[model samples]
Target: MKEHFKVTQRMKRGVRIAGLALAFTVCGAMAWPGGTSRLIRKADQAFELEDYKAALKLYASAVEAEPSSPEANYKLGITYVQLNMPKEARAALQRAIDLDAKVEQKLLLPLAEANHLEHNFSAAKAYYEQEKRSAPTLEKTYQELLRKRIAECQAGEDLMRLPAIYNVSNVGSAINSEYSDYVPVLMPDDKAMLFTTRRPDKGRKSLDANGAEQIRITRMQQGNWQESELFLETQQQMPQHAVVSVAPHGKELYTFFADKGLHVSYKLQSGDWTQPELLKAPFNQGSREPSLFVTDDGKFAFFSSDRTGGYGGLDLYVSYKKEDGSWSEALNLGPEVNTPYDEDAPFVDTATNTLYFSSRGHNTMGGYDIFRSSISNATWSKARNLGYPVNSAADDLYFTLSSDRSTAYISSDRPGGAGEKDIYRILFH
Candidate 1:
């Protein structure tokens, strides 16, 4: 699971240098509120150890105590970046720049990254250029990576300019809670929607602060998704269970586990769901598998796994169902559909032979972006980003297209949402 947090070597070098620069800022003011050298030291230590959540709290305290401390705001902004929250990062970084103009030059890369992630391409490009002016002072490799970031900003700017024609809106409060609700699986019939949510579980004593993930379902009635209720048949099976794929008939469901890989549950003729059965052999390789996408007929399945032989931390793999009802050895989707970076959440449209997923590779604007690739001539084409609003600078993932392809849904932690993450619906043009 920790491997999921790993970044590329180039990014590591940039962050390391940027962090060292941030650590040395002079704290000249005395009697500043919440400002303490001790707090800064502790935050810095936590940040250096990649304990971003802890560093975020400490830095927030430092900023509260010393609102005038440019360094504190800078640290808070960068901490937010590490936490994959670019909107908050941009605000904190901007405040730091306002407090001390010099802090802008020191935090140019983070400012660029945060803005880029938030889809503010112009601001991100400007910051990248400003950082580029001083790029010669850094290592050669990092400078090259910085150039790539600048190009990424330019790409994002271009994409944002030619916006897609789609009506995007929140799915409404009735089906959403103050907590995160994501990874939706809308059945082919479109009558029921199943998803994972982090709303409080009153029965779990060892739940995390965000609450244990549980599966919930809501029905569509009179053209609106009604209020949500737990998917009782498979509820409470795992402390952190998530529904990844549902059969075309909505009678079978697939879920992932850190210890067991991917498993499935079937609804019997009595209309009660059976206990989740661990998928056989190739699908249950006993590593950290996070997502699963199966074909409607159950002939093939695509799943995300971090097991060995991957091109990146997690790569998408497909396994075919053998004649005997067993599975063939998992086959990597190859470099076209995957990259030297993590890829997850594979959704296949067998009708069009299209595959949609989220990836940290392939010309991403920032963080993870949703991408789609279709098969032609028996090979997958280059993955294309879903673009602009459907994808954001934060980790935009868990995308599901409706049966008719006229509507789509995605989960994101992007700002202006109800909580940590929210499901959004987009009506295609």
Candidate 2:
């Protein structure tokens, strides 16, 4: 797993870290209390970050500092669960309830999971059901997943299972195929989508039996995707061959030409694509597969390149489009975003003020998983993996989000895909 590798990497660098198998909790931004706040913050951080042992040690000091801190006590209980010490976990959870009865039901969901893992199904089911009823929109999926867990307990399934349930489903046949379909770019209205696929070929590419390239456009009328149909011949000259990336606005598309050139073709206002133009300067120099993302402001372009001078590997560089519309010489994102290891799949989510990408340099739980960091401030922090189900041992990269910021689509080579790679959606709660 990428995470296991990361822990090993950190340890070799003299950072003592515990591997907490890809467990994640949805969190909201909270205010920093500041100062020796460091001790408690570190403890709370270790707990939230899935490092139970360190969290346990730090929480002890946190409790001593503020004996009446209900939050600290509640976190202590959660850390116990992570450490897989049931008796201690139970006692701490009960102590939390005694100190803050409000957590009795709210935090009980995690408590139930701990109990369930410890073979206390009755308690888990009771708590899980109680928590399930607490949220309306979440009830259905929670109930289903709970049923699966409860069944696993009844059947005596192994506690440590392989290829953890991806909890995945296709975006529907509307977006899938018997042929390879990938690199989806959902337009702002979420109504139109332009994706590249290799189907019903012009009969070229490689002689891999499935050789050919094409483009398909689908309109979202009402609420669902209308039937996907191929593009007109005017836009098909280049055959939409090897679409590596697309800008957020769907106004431009980038691809690798069979002639050993990279083209940045413009989509015209009348729904026609103009003659493909050869990209110069910053882009044309990169390797065959180019990464692209047009930032919201429209002038800055973020992409990956292995141009002559880079920190190392395939570094991500940002180019500023001049007033004359020519892109300036690419500037490396520096070693901060780039690494000795290859980093690709550049995506900008300014809604969260973050840049999401994939890297092998950072501690990973598996092969090439998505990691994101805030760009709102001057200095960007280390990137955090989006974590399991959405990411696995298989390569997971190239993501696009709906403009409203509620849903996202990520490309992966994980099994069950229509082909080598398929796009999966993540609807956040």
Candidate 3:
């Protein structure tokens, strides 16, 4: 009787344990897959919202859970590309293609871009050609863009083989940071530089929260650039400024403030910038203008805007200062200078009557390339690409000349630098 009781009790205990084990197994199977699906959905949503950092983490988790998932790997690669991490993007994209060859057709162009951005021109060209061959029936516009991309790769390869003799070097950590630093405008005699930086705001704990770009000025002391300081007069409790140009004499600073249009702040007697006031009428026509240059005499202002009646995108516009000290109606720089694509960052060399800016439409190898046009007796000439190493497969914009015109500063993302967009000084021999 005792043995019988012990056997029955042991069997009951075993049954209870098995039931608990079965419950856990069933619950885990449902929760694990469902949780992974939820993560993937959230990641896709974040990516569409342009929350790349958030998407990166969530997609990484999805990839971890399902290493063989081609979709997850491909999406992660796209995120990396958007974040400007081309190496990681290339690897992830290649893995996705390996897992599913079908992804190759869908991913070839972005893969090409990744390679191009990393300065792997040969690989980029090959991928672009492959994409071309695979999609022979693509729209004519897209086909043309692809051909431009291929040409860009060829240009990059050519440039790499025989680079210009110009000695390019980082401006040092004093004027540069791990973050981007570009759009540099050097004053006469190289006395000072007012440029845009994504450096953290000194007073803010979370720099990304109100992360409007801050304008910083670096003074040249004893022939070296000193530590940069923010344009405090432009700073609010929440700073906002995108300085596009500084006058040749550095007495006037022009900024593209949101909605309020171009605001000019002149140097005050106290050695500080006066409160920025929006330029009147034609200049403040409630259009998107990203850059401008005011001649030293302040007689004419060359600006970039996408207002109606433009050829397309952002066309260059020039507004002449009237005798009454007011501005005239904005006049498009016209087809000779503007194209059916964007033309921005206009810098006028008043001494030479030359206009130098960046254009995407006029014979661009791939992306925006710096172009120069001579303004002869009030008529603009045909724009010409600055060419080769001065321009790259990546964007090469914001070209500015020093006082003597012996040296030029251009903003570019060409490889082998600190990172995204560093300013390069071209010393003309």
Candidate 4:
């Protein structure tokens, strides 16, 4: 998943931020001092607006001003969760519970989630079970979701016992910055790569501005990746462009535009790319279609969409190229591969006819985890989680492989990362 689009959804789904009125009620009941009360109110406003950085600062001040305030600590903890700082969230949330046992009713789930994200599966499972036994009145759907989360924590516990054989490492400063660098699309030969970065451009003050998500390209020189440069051709006209997939031979590029849908650009013989052309019907027919994978033979294409009639949120679908050079109607990958939660960022290895994607359902430890299912006799096998450290408690998606399969790339916000989401290189042993 692209960090910009999916992170917000993941945070909202996991934490379910409360309203400003609730914060005020808690503050009013506690009778917080004047200065701390003002800070909490302003912090709640920033948090509601999704300005997490600003909210984090304000919440921290509120906590400092009134160390014993359960409401301030609870808000601070949730803000840390939004910023992907699970360790800090764990500290603040645990402190809130210590200060006021009643705050546990409000923060128990987030506390469990913080522990899950920190890879403390056993502790998280205990907390989740406690919530289940205590909250007998939770809505039916939410109860079902809680059961899934508890199962996921159990899965995390079991999967940790059998870690996969892979050496995962950061892609380094050449391709990563303190902002976000993700959705890496490597050229077939492995000499060049294309990716999306949320790093602010020159003269830009904030990532929230237009054109913040820009496509960049870098090439290997002397056994190291050269510093990246903006793919100027993509930025010349569009304010937002994300590279979805690159043709096997690197002659064509598939990109997504906010207003124009999926587009394809061809590389001319003169070493320049043509203006991207929007793909016609049967593609991009929904509110969101963010990822794509085309086979080397160009006979089939797999993509993710949230269009109507899907089993739930986003589901994977496939379309075949017709004899006349048009795409056929899409066929859903079906219930075996998709669940009530989102499935996205499809990639295929034609050699084995395996489909790889990220999903919020299945046995995900917390957020999205990569899974693989192969086609046999025209049916996709049950999806299998790739396991840690290729996947962590944090969201991990956009898994891409080198032609030889010796190395792969994925985007994740796992702990110790250089930024919000950084591209990681996984070497299969």
Q: Pick the candidate with the highest lDDT.
A: 4
45-80 per-residue lDDT for model 2 (tens digits) = 666555465778998778778766656656666666
TM-score of candidate 4 on Cα atoms, chains taken together = 0.89
- The CA lDDT at 369 in model 2 is 64
Give model 3's TM-score versus the native structure.
0.81
Candidate 1, 310: how far from true, in Å? 3.1
Please rank every candidate by TM-score, starting with the best: 4, 1, 3, 2
Q: What is the lDDT for 45 in model 4?
A: 85
Tens digits of per-residue lDDT for model 1, 1-429: 122123324353333224233322322222334445699889988876655667889999988988888778878888787665777988998898898776666777777777776777888788778877876675454565667667666767766877677887889886677678899899879888998887777775323445777888899999999998888744575777778999847788897654556778898899888888888878766667889888989899888887888886689999988899898999999999888668989899888999999987787766578999999997999999888878766667888888898888888877677766889998999
Which residue runs of candidate 3 sit more than 4 Å off their true CA positions? Answer: 1-42, 57-67, 119-126, 132-141, 154-163, 202-210, 237-239
Which of the two candidates, 1 or 4, achieves a greater lDDT against the reference?
4
lDDT of 3 by residue, 300-329 (tens): 889998899988778999888899989898
Best by TM-score: 4
> Model 4 misses residue 320 by how many Å?
1.0
Error of 4 at 316 (Å): 0.6
Looking at model 3, report the run of 10 residues with the lowest lDDT sum.
14-23
CA RMSD of all predictions: 4.7, 19.3, 15.2, 4.4
Model 4 stretches astray by more than 4 angstroms: 1-36, 65-68, 202-211, 233-236
Task: Provide the lDDT at 11 for model 4.
Answer: 35
- Distance from true position, residue 421, model 2, in Å? 1.3
